[model samples]
Target: MTEYATGLVYPNGIAADEVNKVLFVADFTGLHILDLVTGKQSWLSDGGGTYLNGIDGLYYYKGTLIGIQDSGNQGDRVVRFYCLLFNVDR
Candidate 1:
């Protein structure tokens, strides 16, 4: 297990796959998947070349992981958001 210091923030959303015994954690940088049995963590997606930051909601459904990303202030642009679907395998 890993620990973080106070004021160090990340991982905004989470989802659990009971059938596969896995945990999904959404961070501002990427999507993190954790194996409950092995305690190993990996990235499902890194948002490379995509607007996939500020992830606020997470859900797992039928081999797909859905993420809700809120686009925070990027210059004077209006704040927007979008949902992303990722195919995740157990």
Candidate 2:
């Protein structure tokens, strides 16, 4: 298996910009960026920590990556807008 991002547990799928060739991986833990040509990897975000710590369904729309998350808030059905690249791994 290829390691796209570190500390990313349970990555489901990936999307990319065909023009740019930048790869984006989806994980219940967070999002990871992989360079197609350089083979370099980087962490994108934790999706406001609402990913249930391990879930599924990763999609991209209008240059935005959207996914469902639990956020430790059970019994409540709420959706919140989150900033992309909130937590960048160094």
Candidate 3:
């Protein structure tokens, strides 16, 4: 198999949106969205905060990107990320 991505530290969970032709990946480097058609991958930010701590699980449901992250000293919890709020280009 050929490698399709880089900069991922311990990739854990994956969620795919076939209709949108995208894959949301969770890794120690944070979260990223991959365009299946163009082969473009972009890192997703948590709005300029340290809220994202090496996501361990991910889910793409409807229009939301939900993830389970290890908050470090804050413990682990599930978070819902609204793509529109971040102005992510599809």
Candidate 4:
């Protein structure tokens, strides 16, 4: 198994950037991007700076990554129903 960052306590989604040779993982706390060749991992956004908590799925389309976050909380259902978009090349 690959060793992820300490902060990646709950990884729920995964996607790949073939052209960039990187893997994107959606963790419950944030987004982690890993370099396939170097084995280096970095956070795209730590949950504190962004509203990307509870990411559940990932999809790559036309060079963009779509992240689905579902917290399963009844109170904040409106925010949980949205998907986040990130440019793969950035």
How does each model score on TM-score?
Answer: 0.61, 0.53, 0.79, 0.65
Please rank every candidate by lDDT, starting with the best.
Answer: 3, 4, 1, 2
- The Cα error of candidate 1 at residue 73, in Å, is 9.2
Top lDDT hit: 3
* C-alpha root-mean-square deviation, each candidate: 6.0, 5.6, 2.7, 5.0
Residue 74 in candidate 3, Cα distance off native in Å: 1.2
Residue pair clashes in candidate 1? none
Judging by TM-score, tell me the better candidate of 3 and 4. Answer: 3
Candidate 2 local distance difference test against the native: 0.54
Best by TM-score: 3
Worst 10 residues of 1 by lDDT: 75-84
Off by over 4 Å in 4: 1-7, 46-49, 72-90
Model 1, range 22-46, lDDT digits (tens) per residue? 7777776666667666666666543
lDDT of 4 by residue, 1-90 (tens): 866445676888888874656778877666777866677787775445457667778866666677666655332322221224433344
| Model 1 regions lying over 4 Å from their true place | 1-8, 18-20, 73-90
Candidate that beats the other on lDDT, 3 or 4, i.e. the better one: 3
Residue pairs in clash, model 2: 50-69
lDDT (10s digit) by residue, model 3, range 1-90: 845578877889888873767778888777877777677788877667657656788888877888887767288888888765433345
